[model samples]
Target: MPVRRFYKLYLSPSRKYVKTLKNLLGFVPGNLSLYRLAFRHKSVAQSVKKGVKNSNERLEFLGDAVLGSVVAEVLFKLYPYKDEGFLTELRSKIVNRANLNQLARKLGFEKLIEYDNRMISATRQGSLLGDAFEALVGAVYLDKGYDFTKNFLINHIIKSHIDIHTLEQTETNFKSKLIEWCQRHGKDIIFEHIPNQEGESTKLFTIVVNVDGEVMGLGKEFSKKHAEKLAAEKACEALGI
Candidate 1:
């Protein structure tokens, strides 16, 4: 087939891809071309043209930055009294890959990705779905504006889906809580790591958590701090401290 004919054929499918994405997003993705580009796997692009750039990497970049900004804005308004560190940690928790993956799955984004074969499996595992979700947010921002994106996030992602209280209680930071408990009780806590003479892929470490020279807990893990925290958590459970 002639090169020009092949190029024309390729363009034809692109239009259909755009139509699909518009329906998927429940809005016509502006610069629908960008959304199409977002699903194009790098391998597929390479096969088609050596210099051809596809893949959602660029959109992911723009989306990542845009997501960060939007999250920051939301957090600021939600927790006006929160210190920067608290807000930062909360934002990190809210926008982490796992959280985004959950949202993507809920939105059925995995089916929208364009891949050859290998990328499809990995994409189905939620990485690409999450990336495309972020890219969709970026596209929405560019298409509509910040307010629309903000409302979309709050209405669709935050309010409708996320359970704030459950998230807070389940994944509570044990280390921070332990430290705070000790401080409140006027107790000095020390974490001591038993020496590991040999290193291994999963090396065992002994942890002894002492409160005012009394051994409160002991535990073991593949790492020192992890063992210590586990030991401390056990102590917290036992001592109710």
Candidate 2:
């Protein structure tokens, strides 16, 4: 065994932490600090630079992109005859916040996360696990490169835990889900339609979702109902619904 890998697994001060990560991820992290930062929620994070906390938010953004790309490729190959709409909805269902939270929980990420319980509400905690999962993916990508990260996600996480066929069969009405979430929290929700711009397609509809007067998400589709659903999906993702 290499000296560094040997130390991380057996002799390092963070040996236990390393071992736990290995068991969870199936590999020892090349950069331990990235993994640690990936699970650090803003609620318990201290600022490391000019007004920037060393939280997982940035990593989450990176991971979201990487995850989407990998998933899209897989879905594209998996369903060669599927339409764009079908593939898009399935991708959303797979990467939705609720699904990610459930997956993260099943993978034992809750035990690794760092957060201030008093600062975060129960509803918001649902987003925490999902965020950390994405952040961890970002960390893995940075540490191990794209090929390794893609392989790990597919072979280890997706194949082992996720039921793609089951998700494909499921129906998710994001508009209703978003409305229900708002109602539960006593927040106002609105779907605003934008006027068509010059040279824009007349058949296309544009919709934007606002929650409590803040712009949450926007979507453009050929059908009004489909546009609304797309907007609601974006809103849900924005609010981690």
Candidate 3:
């Protein structure tokens, strides 16, 4: 090991954390603070500034983007003859909240994450696990680089844990499921197309799902229908449907 990494593993105050990460992630993190921050839930976070808190939300956002890009590339190469729609659906299945939640649990995120137990129940902690997983991805991207992050994701996470062929056979119509649940509950659910931000691409469609006038979920995609489906998938996860 290099001198810096050797110090972090053997002599640093965060040696225990570093060792744990190595066991969990298959590599030692250079920036111990980023990985630590990644596992911190906002419920226990203290505000570092007026409105900013030392939480994993920002890292989650960055990791979401990075994860998407890597997944897209992998799917593209894996299914060269597949159409855009087919690829998109498969990608969504792989990166869905419910799926990521399961993956995180399998990887033992429950032991590493920091949260307020009083505020979040064990059943409701899956989302927190998913968020932490993404935040960890962001930390890896920032600590290493795109190539390293991609390779790590493909080799350590995807190839080891995920079953792509099984996912392809699984049909999860979250949109239909959400609609049926809403009808059964007598809740007014609406899928609305919203205007994009100034810098956002014109070709991209943003769909927001609202239930009883409350925003349930939001999704962005090149196809409006796909965006609505994505939003409904999120809504379904939020409602535990």
Maximum-lDDT candidate: 2
Tens digits of per-residue lDDT for model 2 on 35-56?
9999999998888879999999
Better of 2 and 3 by lDDT: 2
The TM-score of predicted model 1 comes to: 0.60
lDDT of 2 at 161: 90
Q: Candidates' lDDT values, in order? A: 0.71, 0.94, 0.93
Residue pairs in collision within model 2: none
Candidate 1, 1-241: lDDT as tens digits: 6654344335654656655654556544446666666666555665336754767776777888888998888778887888998778778777776678888888777677676776555424555667777777777777778887788777767887777556655664556777787897788988887675566444798888888888888878987778877888776755543
Worst 10 residues of 2 by lDDT: 232-241
TM-score rank, highest first? 2, 3, 1
Q: Could you tell which candidate, 1 or 2, scores higher by TM-score? A: 2
Best model number under TM-score:
2
Show the lowest summed lDDT stretch of 10 residues, model 3.
120-129
Alpha-carbon TM-score of each model against the true structure: 0.60, 0.80, 0.76
Candidate 3: pairs in clash: none
Clashes of 1: 0
Per-model clash counts, in order, read 0, 0, 0
